[model samples]
Target: MMLIVTGYMYVEPSSITEFVEDLQKLAITARQRDGNLSYDAAMDDPHAGRLLIAERWRDQAALTAHLHSSDTVAFVGRWGDAMRGEILKYDARRERGLMDE
Candidate 1:
């Protein structure tokens, strides 16, 4: 099974640039982790202080590894105070046809 994570972060207006730089670093590190399918971040067009992140992993084990990875830990330690957000995860399965839906 695949895992998908999506969320929005509310950054301090004055810290948006710093937050984006940190997010880019985090995304780069995360993409290099084993079983990482994708990691992406984007700014919300209509919302000045909001940034969105989406992540995909191969499985629960992979996601767990990422959660405990040093990169993630260091990112949190370095930039945690500059933003606030919620991330939600979901188990994903591919559907081949409408009949299967």
Candidate 2:
């Protein structure tokens, strides 16, 4: 099954820039990981410190590999200081979808 990972980060109103930069690096790294379908990030409410991350992986194993990758380590390390909340990981299922190739 394809996995969709969404995360919400509530920052301390400060460190927004640093957090975003770190997330950008992380998104790129996630996309580079094997079996990763997509990885993207966005800032919520314009100037708001809320950050949202979306990811798609081939399967749980692939997602696990991504979590254990060096990029993840660096991502966490780089943003460790500015992190202010918990990261929630959820398992998802697709009921309807189509793609043209």
- The estimated TM-scores of all candidates read 0.85, 0.77
Q: Summarize candidate 2's per-residue lDDT along 1-101 as a digit string, tens digits.
A: 88887877776666777777777777777888888988887787446688777778888999989878887877777776766554566666654556633
Once fitted onto the true fold, the runs of candidate 1 whose alpha carbons sit more than 4 angstroms away are 45-47, 95-101
- In lDDT terms, which candidate is top? 1
lDDT to native, each model: 0.84, 0.75
Q: What number of backbone clashes does candidate 1 have, counting pairs of residues 3 or more apart or in separate chains?
A: 0
Model 1 pairs in collision:
none
- Kindly list the per-residue Cα lDDT of model 1 for residues 1-101, writing each as its tens digit: 99999998787777788878887987888899889999998898424678788999999999999889888888888778876888899988882576775
Q: Note each model's CA RMSD in angstroms.
A: 2.6, 3.4
